[model samples]
Target: MADEVKLYGVAGSPFVCRVKIALNLKEIKHEFVVEDLSNKSAHLIKYNPVHKQIPVLVHNGNPVSESLVIVEYIDDAWKGVPVLPQDAHEKARARFWAKFVDDKCIPAVFMAIGSHGQEQAVAEAHDQLQFLENELKDKKFFGGDSINLVDISAVFLAFWLGAAEEALGIKIVTKDKFPNLTKWSDNCINCQAVKDSLPPRDDLVSFFKMRFGKA
Candidate 1:
């Protein structure tokens, strides 16, 4: 039998969604095992002992943890639509932005949502979104006309950000404030692969409300 690809992930997790989008974009076939994060399964822990987190990709019994790492791996392991840019500089730039989204954008958005009514968190997220808006200026997508690693990395901003906004009753990616980002988010969600991979908006909003105790 051919080696099977198994993904252990949580529903409504942005990180897990990133992996799903990559897989769907690559046309990779895999079995998805939804994990209950509140009571993580032994299979999840065994595969990813260090993080013991969802979004673990188990290929031929080899487990790969971390969403971005799994994305790169999927790009390399499959010969489908390329995720990373072909040029060296462009690839590096894509990677830099992906890391930036993970390290900076996601955290800022979460802090803003979690700390609803806090001026500091909201301001911090605004600054970060402004930076992203500037980066996205003059581009249809982060990869320029097509979704790429950077776009995938920023998937949370497209879907989950709206959910956070709804849950917290706060607005961040407004047209007047972050026009570029707002447009990019629409472009991203409209992409067939992304649209297919995304969880329903209402579900995401509910998840955020429960997780953040907002709304």
Candidate 2:
């Protein structure tokens, strides 16, 4: 008997994307149940009593909240094609970049979205993008040649950050600004699984515009 896997999440969420990408990488079978965070279902409340957040992975009737946690669980549960590197040191490094993308880069892009025409906010967004560009350093992916958890994290950023940019009418993560990162983002989107999973870019742009009151 196989474990029943279900994902409760919204389409636009990066948190959800992390789990989705992991499942795709492992070629795992699962059901995606879309949720409205504004009016959450009883099951979501039951699963994640604390955060009431999206991207809850329900495995064999057990619930796992938070994206990274769910990704790790996916990695642990499915032994083949591990997302993390085999070497201890390399694994640590990959985890570091994943966390970095989550912590620093995400917040910075978000700040720019929530703030417009503010000098500090604009500068902060630029700084964050520049930092990421500097970090690229000719790497094909954040996880080297293969797209691992770190690459997943960064791709989430690229997708949503592009949305936020269009929403804010700001320029960030342009091809000229961060060439390699942009290149890698394109590669990630073009990958068969990733492309299939991606929400249409134009639809995302429209969603962001509505979210930011630009529509």
Candidate 3:
């Protein structure tokens, strides 16, 4: 058990889910410690003093914070499975999209949820989705044909984004609207690693609907 990895995250968190997906993709076995963000813990405070967020990856004894940073660590530490491409340009491209999901898409999509008169917020959210659809139309996955770090960062956008779309009573990305991306996302969710990492379909839908006061 000394060689074990421990992931500090709640089950419902999309951010936490990203770390779970990365660990599985790299074939690293880990223990999961679900945390309550409402009531923070000392360990969480100590490891991620800055963010105090879930998804602090404790590999052996060292603690790595931030989902994307943990993912980079996982890829670098383990040699066999290539998470990020070896080539610098490809690596940059991967990082770029990951940041796009992190900085742009997620926040916009999440904010449009309950904002009643927030027209700008709503427009901004759909604009990002449209941009993603355009970028994704030519590629099988965000990072080429195989699932990579970009794809991992984007899985939430594909699935949770759909749920958010439903709960928010909005349709930023739809099958008829963005058919290619919708199809690609369906493919992403079906991958064994992704499928395993996700909690459950009903649970996800229920949680999101509950958040939007539908459940």
TM-score of each: 0.95, 0.91, 0.90
Looking at model 3, the pairs that clash are none
Candidate 1: tens digits of C-alpha lDDT, residues 1-215: 76699999876888988999999998878999999888999999999999888899999989999999999999999888999999999999999999999889889888888887488888898887787788888899999988999999999999998888888787867888888888899999999989988988999888778888634
The TM-score measured for candidate 1 stands at 0.95
What lDDT tens digits, residue by residue, belong to model 3 across residues 1-215? 33678899888777787888878887787899878888988999998899888789998789999889988898888766677988999899889988998889888877876563267877888788787788787787877777888889988877787776665566666688778788888889888778788876667777767777543
By lDDT rank, best first, the candidates go 1, 3, 2
Highest TM-score model number: 1
Model 2 lowest lDDT segment of ten: 110-119
The alpha-carbon lDDT assigned to residue 165 of candidate 2 equals 76
Clashes within 3 Å, all models in order: 0, 0, 0
Q: What is each predicted model's overall lDDT from 0 to 1?
A: 0.89, 0.79, 0.80
State the displacement of the C-alpha of residue 71, model 1, in Å, after optimal TM-score superposition.
Answer: 0.1
Residues 1-215, candidate 2, lDDT per residue (tens digit)?
A: 98799999988777788788889888989999999888999999999999988989999999999888899889999977678888899889878877888888778777777765366876786776676677667887666767777877777666777776776687755687678778888777776656656777777788777777543
How far does residue 29 in candidate 1 sit from its true spot (Å)?
1.3
Off by over 4 Å in 1: 1-3
- For model 1, the local distance difference test gives 0.89
